[model samples]
Target: MKKFAMVSLAGVVTLGMVAGPATSLASTHEDPSTTDYSDVDTGHEEFNEGFNIYLALTNGDVILRQGDQRSEYVSDVQRLLDTRGFSTNVDGIFGPNTADSVRSYQDTYGLTVDGVVGPNTYQSLSDRHPYPNELFRYGDRGEYVMEIQRFLTEERGMEMAVDGIYGIETERNIRVYQEYSGLQVDGVVGPKTWDSIFTYVR
Candidate 1:
């Protein structure tokens, strides 16, 4: 287990608290996942924008694979793979380690063992692999917890290392997210809290 020095934030928090007074819920509207991908062959402006939108959509094209192509999408897939327990360096490089992890994921999820993230593989991964609504608290350590840390870092703009250890820093970030999402300001991440985060992602 990696040790992270817990940093204190300016809030009165008691560890493991949940179910407080309800706060104003934020609008949980997710934008439609629509994108025109007819121009991927032309490599024009349409191709560029469509390809990017395709990548951003969870059910996007399989442009990321075991090669030297580097992008934030590769890094995002790496992070999701790390969260699913097929550990690989999250350096945004789709190297052998990432390929091996992808293969492992394919095997575990009953997908084709091609070591490539094509449409089928990507869809299965996007749908099946991610955990849904797991309660996270301090002293817990694993990819599940690491996911929350990653969300705080990537989505919510929190400054912290993604070490998979739920310490004070992680809890502090969760509290911040809770406050921002208009949910109860408890550090614990239950289904409601998870839903709030998911709404933001969509």
Candidate 2:
């Protein structure tokens, strides 16, 4: 009887050891390094599903479709972030990974990460782009603004200061150029006005 009891005790201990590992595995999940976000939520339950917040800001409309264009914009932003050394899922869904990358960018650029790209965020992204970002700006204070000032003063012969100051002088020169180009003389360089300026300057 003692021998039988000893064998039963050994069998119970073996079962417990096997069950312990199984229990731990049941409670644990795969590490994110091996996990994929494409298999996760698509960020559709909340606001406009595929409408990228940044493009909406640029176009003066809120995107509500999680379609190809939205995905493209998100992909572009993610690519920018990746170039900036922030690794993200890049799944075209503006979820936690994208939000975190935006926060990282915001923190670096002194922006507020309420997760919405406003004027300041847009300016920051556009001003520091890798290539010449002349087409996507509207007179914010930055290197491109300085470049615009340089173009106006040197190429356009406006006798204006190239100090990156969007003061009355700059506005006047912009309006003058707009009138010359038969634009609306709004003193603001929209896409069409900007294209005209470059066409004339070049």
Candidate 3:
């Protein structure tokens, strides 16, 4: 009877070990590496699914969907979009506003209207929208405005913040840049000014 009891105890311990692992597995799940945000319908929901896609845009490895953070890459995208006539604030955030602008650009350029900045969309933007058509002067606000500020700060060796607003300091720098680049001395960023600036800096 003692040996029989010992055998039954061993069987119970074996069953407990098996059940412990199973119970643990049942209660645990693998953490998802990336949030799947493709099925988001509303603009509000789309903005809520923000992610970071700040990698280089080589071969479209870094996709800018609705929920991407406002990185320098997004700033570049906004510059391109503003150049192409889809006017959206170049605030770097990939919210519904940016998505709507991207879709407009895609539709106008005969690309797929998925509201995503992929390889094809990026290529189209790079190829077509080379520069902003409108004049970027004092009081102008956008990524391109910031780009001019960046060019002034980096290439021409100026000391200032690269804020997107075309404030008095930015205008002063633009005039300086224009004078240095042999362009018109006006503190405006039209096509000719942009051409000269791009030639000098980019």
Best by lDDT: 3
- Tell me the TM-score of each prediction against the true structure: 0.46, 0.33, 0.39
- Cα lDDT tens digits for candidate 2, 110-146: 8886655555655455342232323322233444455
Could you tell me the TM-score of candidate 1?
A: 0.46
lDDT of 2 at 190: 59
The sequence of per-residue lDDT tens digits that candidate 3 reaches over residues 1-202 is: 0010011253342111221221221123322222232332222221112112212453667788887884767877786688667988888889899999999998987999999999788766654124645577665555566666765454335655786666655666666556555777777888877865543322
Name the 10 consecutive residues with the lowest summed lDDT in model 3: 1-10
- Model 1, residue 36: distance off in Å is 40
Highest TM-score among the candidates is held by which one? 1
Q: How far in Å is the alpha carbon of 200 misplaced in model 3?
A: 13
Deviation in angstroms for 115 in model 3? 0.3
Runs in model 2 deviating more than 4 A are 1-56, 59-69, 129-202
Error of 2 at 196 (Å): 12
Q: Return the candidate ranking by lDDT, descending.
A: 3, 1, 2
For each predicted model, how many residue pairs clash, with residues at least 3 apart or on different chains? 0, 1, 1
- Clash pairs, model 2 backbone: 50-66
On lDDT, the stronger of 2 and 3 is 3
Each prediction's RMSD over C-alphas, in Å, is 12.8, 28.8, 27.6
10 residues in a row with least lDDT, candidate 1? 24-33
